[model samples]
Target: MSIVDKVRELCGTKKITIAELERSLGLGAGTVSRWDTRIPGIDKVQKVADYFQVSTDYLLGRTETPYYALTEKDEPSIQADLERLIEDLDGLKYSKETEEFSEETKELLIASLEQAVRIAKMEAKRKYTPKKYRGES
Candidate 1:
């Protein structure tokens, strides 16, 4: 849906008309309606979103859900997992591999390992996020 549609829907929920919304926003009549053909600035978009108590992305129709409360603990939890995995992998016998792996190759391998761990964490969260109190971004 367009910004106009979102605003209209919000107006309905709030029991207000487009003109009333514009007036409430200190915008001239038809200002909000004109947004259908003309994209407004970030400031205006934020204003409207704030007024309606919705995210700008939601008003812009970027997402179906208006809110996604992420878990505040996810970051630290993921970090802890990564640290443990890295510590475990550090003890692995890389002598044979290191003989062939140049300094550059070693760095690349380390980076790749870190990235894989991050991806794994993300996948786990995406597939099995059951905590309503805390969500991962």
Candidate 2:
């Protein structure tokens, strides 16, 4: 879906109209609607993403997952986690010699671990943050 479409969909879920969202964000009239034909500025995109509590990647349709909130600084930590997990798996001893994971399997495992970490972080934020501080009621 287009950025405009995604924004509209999110507005729908929040039970607000596009115009209302524009007003809430202090944007001019029809700014978001124009995104269908024109590429919006990064600042505008970020404002919309922040208002909806979603990542710009989700708003831009780069990712289907709306809440993958990992930032650039978190990338190194995720990589380290993946490496440590892989090493732990490799270190495990079995009755028979353990076979090494295929490259594809390793990739899948890393992706799964990354996603799991993202979910855990999101959950922690939701659980620990005060309701007044969150976007939701």
lDDT tens per residue, model 1, 16-46: 9989888888887788889988988788777
**TM-score: which candidate is best?**
2
**Model 1 worst lDDT window (10 residues):** 128-137
TM-score of each: 0.49, 0.52
lDDT of 2 by residue, 1-137 (tens): 99998998999999999999999999999999999899899999889988877767878887775553455766787678767776786654332446666678777777898788767766666456553444321
Superposed Cα deviation of residue 86, candidate 2 (Å) = 30
Candidate 1's C-alpha runs over 4 A off are 68-137
